[model samples]
Each structure stands twice: as structure tokens, then as C-alpha cells.
Target: MVPTLNAIRHSRRHLARWMRPQRRPVAWTFRPARAWIRYQPLGCIGIIAPWNYPLYLALAPLVDALAAGNRALIKPSEYTPRLAELLARVIGRAFAAEEVAVVTGGPDVAAAFASLPFDHLLFTGSTAIGRRVMAAAAANLTPVTLELGGKSPVIVGPDYGVRSAARSIAFGKFFNAGQTCVAPDYVLAPTHMVRPLAVALLREAQRAYPTVADNPDYTAMITERHHARLVAAIEAARAAGAEVLAHEDAGAAGLRKIGPTIVLAPPAGSLLMQEEIFGPVLPILPYDTIEAAIATVNAGDRPLALYCLTHDAALREAVLARTLSGGVTLNGTLLHVTQDGLPFGGVGPSGIGAYHGRAGFERFSHARGIFQPGRFNGLELVRPPYGFVARRIARLLIGR
Candidate 1:
């Protein structure tokens, strides 16, 4: 909610400047002509927000759409019905139906919403569902901006202190019970530091949330099914002989909660390693060399976010150069997305496009280039039949 409010303030502050036309330089051959890019709204926009961070994800993009001077229709996840209803009521009262509106329902309604012939569609969810939304929009040739999720990784440099890195990692992983899209999915630590890192992470988790079952500070899985899936993954890793550390028992069925848990060196094929563990489960893997650690990240689909904890300039440069992700937070985690100046989205499978501040405004608006020829018209000399003047001008421009 703070991020959403910040986005609103940012849009209000800079929208006028973003809407102004940008003057472009004219080429030497087109002297006295003028060129500029005019920013125009792309008519109606369709937004399909995910269940996690329902209010922020749903309204953040709407902030961009509105700032671009476009009407929008939002489809909030069914998992958050109450918030969806509240969004509908408040937005409906503030704006006319054609200006802005919210739609709430199950998968069918979502599907129908995606199929609408809006000028542009922006969907934030899993990669599998993003594909479906893109396909539905294909029928109308509607442009799409997909903010999807994948396994975001954290890398701890050899020189960085284990406890310091652990503190930040634990904060990112256990915040909202690790349900955040940009949370650290797993860690690649120096071989000798793996055990120490794991211990520190556990210590930090315990200090943060001493009790998980009834702790008001601790968050639960959004649904019972989500809770079950996380438990199954942890148990699968344990069955595969991975070392498991937990703040409490795996989880409580009634509470839909999973205590902060860490799996050390889970088998490569285990569910914990293969899927996006959108819960309080962090896996620590050992790497003898930083190059190998980087290769391991590149081995999978491009992730949405990457974190590198290193003060060394060369090591940080190497990691930055060799990796590809939607965004990177150096020596920290989850802070890159908070800045309104940066563009936030994925590349390859993780996501399609970016949106935030100026990027969001431009994504929802079209830049139409306009050019006006001068009254003298330099091109007139080169347009006639093969005459001496035309030949001379061509030689001067193109060079013999």
C-alpha cells in the first residue's frame, strides 16, 4: 500500500512533463524540417492483477493507465474477493464506469476479461497464465505487458560476512512469509559459507518471528491449498535427504501457516529446487567459484530479480555482466522495485514488459512521430530526371 501511494504521488507530480511532446533532432539532409514525438493515450487498458499484494498490483498499473489519460477495466483475483469488492465500490464512486471500473469473479470472468478488445492489456501473474492472457489478446492484436514471476536468486560473495547477508536474506524471504514475487527463492553461497549462512538465516528467522502459529507479525499462506503445496515441497526435500531447519513444526493445517524453513542443498530435481517456492522456504546451495554460481543462475529461465551481496567492484561488475534478469538489487534485496525512476518487469519467460513511473506512462501511451518539411525543401534538387544539378547533389550527399 505504501508503494501504491508513492506511485500515485509520482504520477501526479510528473504526469504533465511526461505528456509533453519531445522534440527530436532533424538529420542534416532534412535541414529546416521539424520532428517530434507526440505522446498519446492508447485508449482503453485491461489489467488482470494477481492475488498476492492484490491492492498494490491491481492499482499500480491503473495509476499508469490513468496518468496516460486512458480509461481502464480491472479484473482482480477471486482469491481476494473482499478487497476486489472494496476496490470496485471505491473506484466506482470516484470515477464513472467508462473512466475506470473493477470486475470481480472466478476464472471464467477473468478469461472473458482478457478476451476483450482493449487497446492494450497488462496482466501480472504466473508465467503459465501470462501465456494464456497473451494468447487471448492475440485475437484482437492487442498489445500486452505481462509482469510474471520466476525463481529469483540471491548470490553472496566470498568476502561478504555470512551473518550480514543472512540478515537481509531472511528479511526478504520471511517478509509476508516469503510470498513476495521478488523474494529470494534460493541462495548460492561459497562452499565453506553454506553451513554458516544456513545457521545465520535460521537465527534471524527465529529472532524475527519467535512463534509462527499465532504470531500477529507472522503471515500465513493465502489459502489452504497454497499451504499444502509448500508443506509437500518441504517434505519431498526432506525425503530426498536434504538438511531441513525450521522455526517450528512444518506448518499448521488450521492456520494455513508454514514457519520460516530452510532446505540446505536439496537434490537438483526436487520440487523445492524446480518450482517457484512462493512461501517461507529458502534453499541454500554451495558454489566453489563465482563463475559456477553465475552459470547455475543462467541454467534456468531468466528470473524476475537477482541479488548480489558484494562490495568488491570487479566481482560486482562480473556478476552484473554475466547475468540476465528483470532487475537487480546489489548488496540488498527488494529495494529496486520501490524506486519510481526505474522500470520494473521481466525478460524472456519471467515477464514481457516493464511499468513504473515514466516507463509505465510510456508503456500505456503511444509515441507518434511527426515531421514537417521546410518551405525551401532541400530534397527538390534530387527528385528530377538525371540532370547535372541532381547528379551534383547526389554526389555531395552520398560521396562518390
Candidate 2:
């Protein structure tokens, strides 16, 4: 709700500023002719939102779409039907069909909704289903913006103390039990500091939630199946010579509530390292050099967000330059997306396109180019009838 409300207020405050036509510079040969980009809403938008942070994800985009003067049809995740129903009712009370509406359904209904010929479609979910949504939208040539999740990494710089970086990463990784899309998937630490970073991460988690068993402060995994999956992955990593660290368990059941833990140097091929944990488990990988750490991140698909915690400005700038991601949060985690000024989204396999602030307004809009002719405009000299003057002007315009 924090990000969502922030987006709403940001859009309301900035919509007019973004809507102002942008003047474009004209060529010397075309003097007196004016051109500007006029922002207009892309008639109807179809938004497919995900389960995690359901309210924020669905309405954040909706706010931008409406602020840009476009109506929207939102399809909330089936996993959160009750919340979806509440959203529909609340929004219905405020908006008419011509402005905004919600469509609640399961997978098939979502598929049908995605196939509709909306001017634009924005999807926020996992990478696997993101492909399917893009394919379905492709059938209608609907432009899409997908906010998919990837294995975002937190790098502990050689010059920085593990205590500070580990503290930030722990808060991010365990928030909502690591279900956040931009949560730190794993940590890349200096070889000598791997053990220290692990211990520091556990310390931070303990400080945050001392009683992990049924502690309301600790969020539960989405499902029993998800909990079981985390258990299996941890077991697999343990079997593959990875040390798993967890706090003293108030042992009743590991079903929905798994204690915060960290994995020390899980094998490169293990499930703990391969997939986005999206649970209360953090994995730390040690590297000998900065180049190797950057290489480790570049080896996989570009992540949605990269966390670099270092006091050295040169090292921070170098890391940002070498790596590609949807966004970056220096010396912190998950806070970048909350900033209304910066655009947010992923690159390559991480996701597609971006939105937020003016970016969001523009994403759901078409910047229609408007060209106005002046009384003395000389463009006619280079129009259809090609003569010596026309040919000469054309050549000049083409930089020949």
C-alpha cells in the first residue's frame, strides 16, 4: 500500500506536468515550422496483476492509466479473490464503467481477458506466465508491459562491513517472507566475508523477529505447498554440502511458517542457487574479486533490481555501470521502487518496459506528434514535385 498510495499521489500531482506538450527542435531548412509531442491516453488498458501485494500492484498501474485519461479493466489474481472482491466494490463505488472496473476470475478467465484487444496491456507476475500473457496479447497486437520477477542479488563490497549490508539484505529478504519481486534473491560476498555475512544476516533476522514460530510479525508463505517446496530446496542444498543456519525453532510445525535462515555458499547447481527462493531463505556466495562478483551477476538473466552496498563511490559506480537491471538500490534494498521519480521495471528475461512517475503516465499514453505549419514554411519546396531546388533541399536535409 505504501508504493501504491505514493504512486497515486505522485500521478495526481504530476499528470498535468507530464501532459504538457514537449517542443521539438526544428532543422534550419524547416524554420518556422513547429513540432511537439502531445500526450494522449491510449483508449483502454488491460492490467493483469499478481497475488503478492495484490492491492498495490493492481491499482498502482490503474492509477497511472486513469491519470492519463484512459479507462482500465483490471484482472486481479485468483489467489486473492476476497481482496479482489473488496477492490471491485471499493473502486465501483468511486468509478463508473466508463472509467475503471475489475474482472475477478481464475486462470481461464484471465486468459480470456488477456486476449481482449486493449490498446495496451500491463502484466505483473512470474516469468513463466508472463510469456503466456505476452503471447496472448500478441494475437491482438496489444502492446504489453510485463513486471516479472527474477533472482535479484545483493553484493557485499570488499571495502564495506558485512554487518551493515547484511542488515539491509536481511530486512528485504525476509519482508513478506521474501515474496517481493525485488527482494534480494541471494548475496554475493567477498570470499573471506561469506561466513561473517551469514552470521550477520541471521543476527539481523533475529533482531527483527526473535520468536519465529507463529509470530504475527512474521508473514506466512502463500501456501502449504510453497512451504514444503522451500523445505525440499533447503534439504537438497544441505545434502549438497551447503550449511543451512536457522534460529532456535519453537518446533510445532514448519507448515506455513518457516524460520528465517541463510545458506552458506550453496553449490552453483543446487536449487537453492538456481531458482528465486521467494521464501525466508537467503543464500550467500563468496567471490575472490570484484570482477568475479560482477561476472556472477551477469552470468544469469538481468535481474529486476541489484543491491550494491559500499562506501566507495568508485566501486558503486563501477558496479552500476557493469551490471544491467530494471533498477538499483545502493546501500539499501527494495526502496528504489518506492521513489516516484525513478522508472521501475526489468530488462531482457527479467521483464519488459518500465513505469512510475512520468514513465507510467507515458507508458499508458501515446505521444502523438503534432506539426504546425507557418505562413512562410519552406517545406513545400521539397514536396512531391521534385525539381532542382527540391532535389537540392532534399540533399541538404538528408545531410548529403
Candidate 3:
């Protein structure tokens, strides 16, 4: 934990090391039609980061706001106070008090903080909290970039590498106890491969982090309330006629260590399928055909990320065009966020805005157009004289 923590601290400071010498420091040009635009700065931005991935999520947006030359007031989630404090200290060391400030508090503090008329607000958390954040920001008519999470799905096609797919899915779904916003919420495996995928996931999870009981790699639920809620959700789904599949050598039942749980053939409205399961539970739904699985995801709100396992390029492109996820990965998971160039964000209910790479810097700053007009030009056609001859030329220019 100490070594990992130290490395995270090191990485946060070095995140912008490669960004200094770029040809365009604050802007990116993908086409050649643009002239140099002045670097516009933004005012203070308020960032509300979530408990999961507190360090990365908080620092990513903070770095973006700073890169755009904006001051920031970050409110780290109260659930992880120790981590929150550590980050606050690190940020203080890196920046001045006026440039960046970290505030740690509860719900009331969050409400008060959000009410400030910040230039913009960047929030990463649950959909329920996102609504309140949006509403509070609306009080001042402030723009916001929300990074909310929903039930992101993973589809396993028959042509996929099942062993590799299982390993990736298991690491993502159960990593941080399945608390990731973009985690593979549930897997849609081919009907014939459903059982095999589940078996593979169980084996891979055990192999990746041996001894789920004493495994330091495994993350504990943030709070007792959250843990209880997860357990209740599992029980409710079980009572609703859902089949729960157990994994071996999981752990003793009393260690507050909920083992790797798999639910097979869960009803669409079942609690397990309805909401985001932020636990070590993986719901495996079987589909007879790949088309049926795609339809299932398309019917729901667009997810933060989608993981598809297939070897066919045509099929991959078809899925990419048909589905509206924020991001997609072919035969892999959680690697999209690692790409510094690709924009990171969500779509629709999953989220409203994206921020990463140049996108992140742009999100924090306003783009004001600067049109330097020539000394004497086409404007003479619309002079105050307003003669018929001049009117004819004005109409040509203005499309009157």
C-alpha cells in the first residue's frame, strides 16, 4: 500500500511532464483550417470527486483546470477522508493557496460548495448525486461537466478469446470490489458459453488475487451501510428466483468478505439487473444470439463504457455504430481511460461531458472567437447611406 501510494503521488505530479513541450500547449489541431487562437483563461472551478479512484479522478480534473490557467476548489468525497487529506496535502505542495484549494467535508459542505458561482463544475459520482449537483449549479446558471456511472455492459461473442476475455472482465468487474463507474456491470455471454465464461472468471479472479480473505489487493467496501446494501441487493435478487453461483475458496462467511458471486438468468427487472451492483457480484446473462445482446444494451441508457470481445472487424464496427456507449474496447476492458489522447467521459444518462487530453483543457476554458477584420473590406456595401446600389451588394454578402 505504501509503495502504491507513493507511486500514485509521483504520477500525479508527473502527469503534465510530457505536456510542456507540445507545439500547441493549450490547444490541439486536427485540421489545417484554423489560425492561432489566443489562450483564454477560466475563473475558479469547483470539482467534486467520488470515493472510488479518488486520487486519479480528483487529480485528472484538477490538472486540467490548472492547465487551462483556472483556479480550483476541490471537494474530495468524505468516504475516503484519509486519502482525501493526503491528496489535499500533495495539491497544497504543488500549488498556491489561491490557485488550488482542497476542502473536505460532508453533504452540507458539498451543498454550500456547489452553490458558489464557479466558472464551471466537474462532478464524478452516482447519478442521484449528479442530479443534485446539476440543480445546485443551475442556481447560478453555471455550466457543469458531470461524470456519472450506470450499468455498463460487456458482450462476449462466440469468436472471442474466452480465457482472455474472462480474465479482463473479472479484473474489471471485481476490481475495487466492482466499484468502478465504468466497470463491466454485467456480462452478456453467448448462451453456450455462459457457464464456461463464469467458470473462467472464477478461476481468474482467484488466480489474480489469491486468498480473497487476506488479499490486500482486494478493496473493502467504503462503509458498513454500503456493504449492507450490497448484501440486501444480493438477497433480494436471490428471493426473486435468480440463481446464485458460488466460487471456490472464496472466504469464510463472517469476514465481511462477500465472495465472488455470479447470478445466472436474472429477470430484467430483478434488483440485480435493475441497478448498478457495486460489489464483487457479477451477473451473467445468456443470449442466444449476439444481436439479442446488443438489443438489450441499446434499450437502456447509454453507458460510460462498453467492452466487446470479438475477432471480426466487420462485427466490431457494426457494434460500434449501432450502440451509443461513451467508449468501447475490443477484446479488452478499462484500457480506454489509460489513453491520454482519447477523450474520457460518458454519454446521455451515464454522463453529460468528456474531459481528457486536449478535451479536458478545452472543457475548463471558454473558446471566444477572435476575428481580426481587414482595414477596408466588404463592409462598405452596408454603409449608413443605404442606397439601392449599395443594398444590392449588401444582399449578396449577407444573403438578405
Candidate 4:
């Protein structure tokens, strides 16, 4: 946590240096024949952060808000109070109370926070909760930026190395114990390759986290409710005829240990296929063609992220051209969010706004247009009623 906070502090200074001199673009040049206008500053902003990656998420928007010269109010997730208080202290050290304030509490607090007439609000969380936040913001007609998560998918092509592909995919799906919104919910591999890929994935999972029964690096589900939900989700998939291909009877007691399992051949309408399985339980489905995989995804909400493992450039290009996801990763997963210079949000049910790089700046800013009138006297034709001269001037000026 300390290390993460230190990184945030470093980034804040770096961004401040870059943004300090950018009040308006220096490229604006006055023409002798144009109209004049000026840019304006937005007042203040509000941000609601999620429990996962609390410090980083909170500080990310704070960095943009301060750099954009707008005061901000932050409502950190009540689920993690310690981190929220820690943020308040750190930010207080760096800014005035009013410049960045921290508010705490339950859904009611969140509602009140969202109802305030903020110039802009940025929220990060589940899509269901995001809808409520959006509805609250609508009360004030406040502009909002939502970073919601959905069922991200992975496609494993036969052309790639199965072992290597499975290795990378395992790390991504189980990272943070699959709490990540962008984690691959299910896998679409070739029908003939499913068993081979599944075997390789289990092998890689063991390689990545040997002794998951006692590993400290593994993150527990945030709450008992989530843990039960994950368990129930897996059960529902199993009852519906999906074979639980891995982790049999390992996760019991309060250990909160779910050793990277996979469900095989789940029916098309099973819960495992319909929702984001944000756990270590990976589901593998067989696909005859990549086109069929694309069609399946296109039928649903635009995913937050889509991943594919293939060696052929043509196949990769074809898939990218035909499908829409918040982000696409070729032959890998979850690396796109690490690109600090790239935008990191989604589209459609996955999300609506983007932030990171230039998108972050634009999300917190309102770009006002400026036009300057020239000194040339080309418009003094007929300043009055209706005449032939006025009509001609109108035709030339208005292009009527």
C-alpha cells in the first residue's frame, strides 16, 4: 500500500509539471479575418472510487482534477475504511481540505454525494451499481464518467502455443483472485483443443501459484456475500450440466480458498456463460470457428476487454475489425491497463467513459471554443433594411 501511494505521489508531481503550463494551447493564432472567442475553466469535480485498487483509483482522478485546476470531492468506498482514511491523510498533506475532501458512509452517503451539483463525477464499480449512480447524477443533470465492468472474454486459437497461451490466461483470470472486472470470464478455444488447453491451464496455474492452499499472495473475496455468490455461481453452472473440470471439494471452511478451477462444456444459456464469473473458476467452451466466437460476443454488451491468442496477423486483424470491445489484447490479457499513457475505461454495458492518458484530461475538462474576429473590413456592405446590395452580401456571408 505504501509503495502504491508513493507511486501515485510521484505521478502527481510528474503530471503537475506537464499540466502547469497548459492553460490553453499555444498554437492558437489570430487571423485577420476570423471571429474571436476564449477558453473557460470548469469549477469543481467529484469522484467515487471502488474498493479494489482504492488508493490508485482515488488518486488517479484527484491527479487529473488538481492538474485541470478544479477542486475535487472524493467519496471512497465504505467497504475499505482504512484505505479511505489513509487517502484523506495523504491528500491532506498534499492539498487543502477543500481542494480535495473525503466523505464516508453507506449507500445513502453515496446518494447524497451524487446528488450534489458537481461539475463532473467519475465513478468506478459494477455495472449494476453504476446504474444507480447514474440515476442519482441525473437528479442534478450532472455529467458523469462511469468505469463499469462486465464479462470480458478470451479466445484461444489453435494456431498459438497452447501451453504459453494457457499460462498467460491463467495469470490474468486469477489475478486478484479474479476480482478484476476485466479478467477473462470464460474461454473460447477450438473444440478439438479444449481438453489440451484445459490441461495446460491447470498445469500453469500450479506453476504460477504453487500451494494455493497456503499462498499469501492470493487475495480473498472482498466479503462473505461475494464468496457465497462465487460458490453459488459455480454450483448453478454444475447443476445445469456443466462439468466442473477442476478444483473438486478444495474450497471449504473460511479459508476462502478456491484453487483456480475450470468448468467444461457449459450449456449456452448457463449462468457461467451469461454472467461475469469474477472468480478462479474458468469456463472453457469449444468453438468451430473464430467467426462464431465473434458472433457470440457481438450478441451481448460490448465487453470491457477482449483477448485472443493467435499467430496469424490476418486472423488477428479480421477479429479486431469485426468486433467491438472496450480494449483488445492480442495473445495476452490485462496488460493494456498497465499502459499509463493509454486510456483505460469501456463502452456500452462495459462502461461509457474513458480515463487515462489524454482521455483522462478530456473527461475532467470542458473544452470551450474560442473564435476571434479579424480587423479586415470585408463585412461593411449594407448595415440596414432590404436591398439588392444587402441580399448579395447575405448570399456571400451566409451562403444562402
Q: Which candidate tops TM-score?
A: 1
Task: Identify the superior model by TM-score, candidate 1 or candidate 2.
Answer: 1
Off by over 4 Å in 2: 251-255, 383-388, 391-400
- The lDDT of each candidate is 0.93, 0.89, 0.80, 0.78
Give the Cα-based TM-score of candidate 2 against the true structure: 0.96
**What lDDT tens digits, residue by residue, belong to model 1 across residues 313-356?**
99999999999999999989999999998999999999999999
Using lDDT, rank the candidates from best to worst.
Answer: 1, 2, 3, 4
Candidate 1 Cα RMSD after full superposition onto the native fold (Å): 1.3
How high is the lDDT of residue 108 in model 4?
A: 89
Q: Give per-residue CA lDDT, model 3, range 136-204, as digits (tens).
A: 999999999999988889988788877988888987888887888888999998888988888888888
User: Candidate 4 versus the native: TM-score?
Assistant: 0.89
lDDT of 2: 0.89
Whose TM-score is higher: candidate 2's or candidate 3's?
2
Q: Write the per-residue lDDT of candidate 2 for residues 36-76, one digit (tens) a residue.
A: 99999999999999998899899888888888889999999
lDDT of 2 at 326: 95
Model 1 stretches with alpha carbons more than 4 Å out: 249-251, 384-386
Clashes of 3: 0
Clashing pairs in 1: none
